[model samples]
Target: MTVGGDGGPSSPEAGPDLDAVRYLLVGYSADLLVDLDGFLPERSVAVVETPDVIEARGVRGQIGAVRCLAAVLAAPIQDEANAVRLVGLVPRPPRIGAVVPASDYGVVAAATLAAAWGLPGAGPDAAPVFRDKAELRRTAGGAGIAQPEWRLVTGPAEVAAFRAGGDGTCVLKPTNRQASVGVQILPPDADVFTAWALTAGAEEQMFRPGDAGGSRYLAERLLRGPEVSAEVLVRDGRTVFFNTTAKDVQPGRHPVETGHVVSGPVTEEVAAALATGMRALVEATKFGSGVLHGEWIVVDGVPHLVECAARLPGDYIVELIAMAYDWSLLHGFLAVLEGRAADPAPPVARGAAIRYLSAAPGTVDAVDGVEQARAVPGVCDVLVRVAPGDTVEPVTSSWKRPGHVIATAPDAPSAARAAEQARAALTIATHPGAGR
Candidate 1:
């Protein structure tokens, strides 16, 4: 998930090209794929995906310099078998010097592929601990890392048992899913049977051919306090926090992250607490290297682990971090990918924020304010998802976000205000319709 665009041609920190390193990125989508023109030499990256998909994401247009190897990547998350198949597709000569997963789903595959190629990052051994929430809790608990009380619940009976033990309310999350896809907070009086039955056929957490409908849920105590995510750069088991972002979310059944503000003002006390917990998490998981997007909730001033991803944070966090720090995070990621040290020092201070646009489930009728949002002061970018005819659904995960506005200012409050104003200026008209 090392960045491509900022390193493509603009930034002075793009550094000397690492053309000698033939890196293989096992990916799920081309949506955020960057043109690694300046980071890596042309024709050096071979992306495994279908031709149409490559075109659909503007991959050919955005990252046409990289090679696109047509193949059907069916699963969002892949197992070792998928990794093996992806490895077989690589021609023997060039020899991939590094392996990177383009998304969370591709992490296990990247690790497995790296192990096969004798690359630097964590191998298949670290996959399960990072991929499965249940496994993650077990490992962290074994290491005495503080976490919300949790248990792997396979059925209604187990859910009942878990509730009877402690808090009547619990949060249920898919073991392998990201973006809080199947994360739901069950109330004390909610029907466990209905909850289990409704989530029984959920397939977004699918890995291999089997285990699709098995116990994909992990029930845990609903931790209080503000939610935040740490964007850390880890190299050879050493980790550094680049930025901590405050999240604005609606965790009503389906967790929907609405906005983010770069948290620059951290009390030294809270900082130490977060560092201790995050460091313990890194050690417990044995995440040898690469970028980690760690989610945490600070309850009663103590940070508890939510989840950590062995990849970059989605939703333009990398880009936002760069705007805030005025430092090349993507370059740091690239350095780490090559098993080298990265200067994560902040050279400048600023704030960047992103606010997502949510729409009611309906059909897009008329839309306005794209140009207006972009014109707002500090507004860096404005993305609109719905069109005149496209059906817009209530946001589930980040999939249904109507659009988002990114802005930056000298400080966090200003930046957040800019984002809010920018998003508010936009207008979306819709009619009631079926969810997408």
Candidate 2:
């Protein structure tokens, strides 16, 4: 079975006769639903839906298998309710598996479902540290690990006070958000009060969906150095599977990732620093099962913790890593989920880099040279998530990326150079729009 996101069907074999695997897709939309029926193996493809109206349309003879989508934790509570209600309609269904993130809502749903279904999950108190950045910082710090110096500011007045001192350089980030969605870097000479409003106030406005806003936030001093990420699989008090990669942040942003490259070649010193820091985070959080993707910065040879994510890394990061190292992280994750052990294959190369295709700051009119860029040597695949006429917003959050260019090579410099050449080879044309 294959899971598909916006780019397209992750697996090419959507046919009905693919009796080898059972695919559980998160949500199937345009990329999988359109003009895909003929290609589907008659015995392999199955359609799963949680919406009753969709189910009522008749699923019996339309596909090989049909199952109600039951999610323990959906991004929104409304989605969770819909999924659970739909699952109740299915008879003699297989036992359900819950998906957990570090979000507050995700924590509650995962823990509650584990208790109800007798499944496994992290304890309630430990889950909070993953959700709350402020809590996580304190926990890691108390464990003798280094973290960015940060404070929890309850109000705009406190934000002003925190911003007033120091080199006038700090970062304001939402405690509950990821991918640097509500994070902003401060200017050295900027007005403390005004900048504070834009940084902290914007965070409140962004997360205030359904009248729930104005949550607590964190203001941390930014760390300087090259960023590194570790994808560590922990189970039964042991680091079962581990893959460390280099994180490429946005040019001017603090920790907002534009893309990633795996198989990072680090000296013995840096690698040791990373291992020590990761062990600290795992011990402090008491996370026994599942894989975690964490970020850190090598500051003057010392590694400092950025943040930790208790789920699979976002985007096609897992796919990129696989392409570079010839290791399947998705398969590894499924193995761990089933209480089996996962060991990644030996590293094939020293480095692999993924470069994002971002539109210039304006309204996108057209994109050109995609075919030409793909023809470049060493470039494996080019995925353009947005279309020519799609309005290109200025890069604010990590998801603002238009697409990605993935390449692998013998070393980091070679991979980075190839990615740059490929990025420059393509051009995006933006016309005048309402956007500035």
Candidate 3:
């Protein structure tokens, strides 16, 4: 971590007061930590992450009083044994009031640690279900939630069989991967072998070095409709807060998210259906107090399951939710994780949206108009991750998208327009050549 802090006493024996309320974050997330600092400014935080993540995404200097512990918690597959071993690495802080995962790969480990330490979390049983899509499908199906036809495929033959029965259009994805990695939609005439090769070969090895679920894959019949996600906060198996976020994805073989608008305009019926599906999902997972990012495809006003995550939503959705609702979602999340009651419902105070920045595949020559984009009316923030001399690859996944602009207005449409206008103000000039 670039940001330095007191590596709290080498061992628990040498630590400070035993009654201090310290939080254990199971992965390295600068944004999460910053929010934690704002929510509970006085509380101490201890983070457990692999050396690579800390090195790649350095910690910011603003988050006060953080302790960094470099440890190996990610593995080829996640299980209770690995989780237990990870817990043993913690230096036994006095009172760990809550255990939260800062990343998708850390969900199971964080839940297991929380259970072992008797802290508030999603609970051990439900965490694994949240990570594995196949298990989630079975659990959600048993709960009578609507979902597309899906099957576990061992190879191309199984995929072919699945397509043979249906219209031949199917979606293939890894059971356990984040950032839309290894997710692809195959049309009827698509080559099954080539698609399988691409899906199986995709991996987010930077933070999660190996296949978290041992190369498990799911093939599902494609559901045609708009995609939206519910940002839900649950306490003791009951949902206390819910907000629907409308999303847009790049049109191609890969379903990479390109934009998101929180509390966007939707029919009352569609909103109710999404709420119902989210409630059923919470009940099925038996998830305890925490945040759930559940996604669905609305087909004829019915919400069909896409997948869900047990941690905070990515793509700046949390920030947008806070801006739209005029409340800190991170604060509510921490409160719930600490076994406290969160506001049963928070009204939307405004509209917020985020639009990602992209460029053609080539080498970046220069990035211009970032300042002008930031100055656009209603544009809250604008960031460009690419710079001169950097390579700009095709937008195959969320990570490949360069950066984004976040905007807010009195309503969803206005906010979305503002985001787009701000995005249009900037230009990422690239050389006409294949990216490295």
Candidate 4:
């Protein structure tokens, strides 16, 4: 592993002096780190990532200005001890600005390191609550926040009992996994054993073998309603910016998100309920500073908590939020993390939406219409991650989806329509009969 200060000599006895660094970025996202480097070109950044990710992403070559520190860990960084060790690679803690997580797996480590260093971040005790769904449910429930009925299960019989106790249907998911990897919605007559096996065996592709979360699971009574996520920025346990994002999910055993629209309209009552729920969650978690992405199901104008994350949201939602509001969420997130107040969100200037690309499960033969999709009115970007000879699997999770199209317009419906139209303009021809 390579570890050194900025343009300094490497020595085993004398480690790098990180005193000049202002931010310690945890996790690996090449594009995000580069953007952050651009945002604060003058400020020094120290990044902690696995050696494999550093090599695969060419992180050092991409972000020349950012100092790259690699650590070969016995466990994932989400593990608090491993997180501490990863950040400890820096000879000394940087300035008292912030420690930021670039991905879901970095939240706990970032929070823990920030607290230990006396920098602004989610409280050390509260970061794990955001990562673990069961704990989040308990915390939110204790705060009198509404949520669907849920229970932890370790075996098939417990899942069966939970389903039986519910209204003949339930959702089973891993307590700590993200991107819907181990999530499934079972009907009244669904096979409990098969569902349990599938959910238990699921794993995230990003992690190395044996580095994923444990086999903990939760069975919850599935609530029905329009699903939305609240993107919020908080400082000193107070909300400074909040926006409601409308969501679309695949209707099947796995509820993988398909799209999201920022600054979308909601009824007055539902908006109020969402605000109240957000406040309750912030207080319950005792979150100190940074971004909070909370999901909810609005039933009868009441928003029920669906788990939240302390890190920046995935799936280009941050970019969409910036486009819709004519401001930078990244800027606000950095500001709050640096112990400075975030700028109050302005009124929605436009609507921004993203629609993901999907094709039948098979081997891709050809891709077409990408440029045409980009030419569509209001279409800002269209990205197709698959190519000829690539295998396209069933959309069981966010990573399985191939690509997406982003659009902006005067209103939410118009932006959503434009995004869908642009997505329809593209095509990925696949040879059928490849099973998932």
Candidate 5:
């Protein structure tokens, strides 16, 4: 894993800095990977493992305590088993008690693992209400929140009915998935059978079968409007609303979140609607504490709750918010874990945004304009993950992304424009990789 200092290198202290409590950032090292130049210097910390490796790397002592519980890093079954094994090896759970999973899959897996070990964690039962699209819609509906008309279909019969007599158009999506993978827009008089069949197959690949549940998919009526997400942090059974962000969904689809502009210039009315919808979610999910990532669509004047996750927003959304707001949410999570109160200081900066450098599906042969993109003013920095010889796949989900450029500016629009300019300057060429 990579590490950096915020200001200057810390003076080599006597032994490892074990005075402060330690945190185990589970998941791909990417989440904690960024802005460490700014995040470090505050204290001394250590990382468990790298993203490429599946097994956990043992870290002796760097902080006050030790524990392994990162959701994103534990996605593959092997990683999950390793995380559990690490916890078991510790003799006891870390004194600094809390597990803040930043990914949807992480939250559920972390919760399940923590609970299995009798630690205070969000379990599958509490997690599904937010992680599963079908479950979120159903839970919101039961809580009297307005949801897009939805149907849980298995085979031909259910798909036929939803296609025959539902709204004008319906969106078919996998139940246990995120970032709009295997999502299809259903058309009227559509080849309902064929489309449904394709959607089902996508779900199987999207989720590890026999691991969670079975054959569960959502046929949801497509809602139209400006999209927004309320990224709120819950603490001690109370709601601590963070900055709201504007989302750009895949052009004709609803679930596919292509990119996001933090703190969009939205109307007061829209803000109120977003806040109201989020409040409803906080209640519906019974989310006493932790992150509540909720998305909404403002239709005509009514704001419908699209879906929610009991975790932090991905693609460094929380990082941008932390930078803009001058708060360390990752640290706040730790504080909450230590039963400390949060300081309510709003964001000081005006804008922060991330534009993903997406590419067409193919094996990557070359990438160009990196130097030019880096030279753009207001373009903070570019960290390209895919190399010249790496294969690049279609932008189906957040995982298939080429890389992302995070930019900050005086306002949202300027930041967005700079990001787009940076994106436009780059190009990627793909060819068949060695194996596949």
Candidate 6:
């Protein structure tokens, strides 16, 4: 599958020299803060984060390692307006080179600040295009792109109208949230009150104020087919394909992604269609320079855009691509951003998969088989997130996962099998009614 643009020359004027440019990573996740060292040049990157996230997210140890740090109004998504303003408040803010949003929430802030500085990034114009689902549909739909039938709903009456005459199985979710936080597949008998309740209180606002959860939602017709994600890098309107991920999400009220397989089982035809749709999407949004994590579904040999983010994909997909390609997507992204020579083509066609470990809802008493899982053939790492005395709840979203295992093999099947074996090897003990 090829995702090529008009074959224009590299935009040498995209940004300043890599060494001369200072990167502003806008968010606070311990993993993201630490990993920036690999994608970015050390001593050239700074951060703007909320004070509480710095403490609650367990990034305290990273404070000394960062090049520089500043506090904003609140969490990245919680107070986006103030977060953008905080950039100018930082010392030597004018010297900032490029703005890199660490997550979806910081996208708007990155765009806002980047526009003010005239730096290389997704500008303020494209923020709403990617941040709001309704905007995505409007732009992509106007560009003659195919997508699932969706109805924008602000309350129960709209939900009722969409459900009364439509199929019972549909995906309804918040217009602004991610990680499947408020997404639910309503049962046929479910009513508008259920929809409101599902979308309203499902968010962890993190001290947000004033429409932080958003006032709109969408009810999308469920399309059944294999779902895949394409990571695209856009520079000066010239787009190129990065990689594809095969996703597996359970069909339920709260569908959580079970695992992912990189460069997994996708037909050549479908791949080509996905690449084309992704290029169209990038063009539609006017995303000049940035990495897009776009999801799509293949129906009857045609690719329909599902959703996308103006940032990189999370859940170790970057690491998985690195393992398969023997290259860092970050560096490739940097090359694209700076208009330098870079190739995202996979050097070796290998498969990589990651599986999460979870158990029945209860209070964690004992965990077993971490080492055993790690010892599995082709398994790379096993990370456990819970310990004894930590209460566990029924997983409703990807954030609730306790641990995960990553593995690689010659093919997707073998990789998936290895990942499953590794996760199956682990054992977590818990007691019922112990979770709060």
TM-score of each prediction: 0.84, 0.76, 0.89, 0.91, 0.76, 0.86
Candidate 2 lDDT over residue span 259-345, tens digit each: 666766666788888887877887887765666777888888888888887666665567666776677665565455445677656
Worst 10 residues of 3 by lDDT: 68-77
Name the better of 1 and 6 by TM-score.
6
lDDT by residue for model 1 (1-436), tens: 2122212333325532333336666664454335344456554554443233333454434432443321122222344435556455443224456677776667877777676777767557776678888988998899887789998888889988897788688887778877766677788898888877765644443222344224468889988888888777878778755568888887576677899988645566666776676777778777777887778888887778898888878888878888888776667776777677888667448889999987667888878888888998999999887788788876666776888999999998889999999998898888898534
Model 5, runs deviating above 4 Å: 1-30, 33-91, 109-125, 203-215, 252-255, 363-365, 430-436
| Tens-digit lDDT string for candidate 3 (217-284) | 99999999999999888888888888999999988888999999989587898889888888888787
Off by over 4 Å in 3: 1-21, 50-91, 343-345, 434-436
Per-model RMSD to reference: 6.6, 7.5, 3.9, 3.2, 7.1, 8.1
Which candidate model has the greater lDDT, 1 or 5?
Answer: 1
Better of 5 and 6 by lDDT: 6
Model with the higher lDDT, candidate 2 or 3: 3
Scanning candidate 1 in windows of ten residues, the lowest lDDT window is 1-10
Model 4 spans with C-alpha error above 4 angstroms = 1-19, 50-76, 81-90, 212-215, 433-436
lDDT of 4 by residue, 281-369 (tens): 88888888989999999887788988899988888999999999988889898898888877777898999999999898898988999
Which lDDT tens digits does candidate 6 get at residues 1-436? Answer: 1111111123223421223236666665556656766545544655545555544554434434553332222334345545455445433344555677767777887767666676667767787678788889889899888899887987877777777656766778887777888888777777769668867778654423234535478888877788888887777767755577888886567777888898757888887777788888877777777789888888887878888898878888888887776777776665654445457565546789998888878999899999899899999989989998888887877888888999999887789899999999998899987754
Error of 1 at 186 (Å): 1.4
- List lDDT for all candidates, in order: 0.70, 0.58, 0.79, 0.80, 0.61, 0.71
Clashes of each: 0, 11, 0, 0, 9, 0
Residue 187: error of model 1 in Å? 1.6
**Clash pairs (backbone) in predicted model 5:** 6-37, 26-70, 27-72, 27-73, 71-106, 325-347, 363-430, 363-431, 365-429
Best TM-score among the predictions, by candidate number: 4
| lDDT string, candidate 5, 46-65, tens digits | 33232323222222222222
Candidate 6 lDDT trough over 10 residues, lowest sum: 1-10
In model 2, which runs have C-alpha deviations exceeding 4 angstroms? 1-108, 191-214, 253-255, 348-350
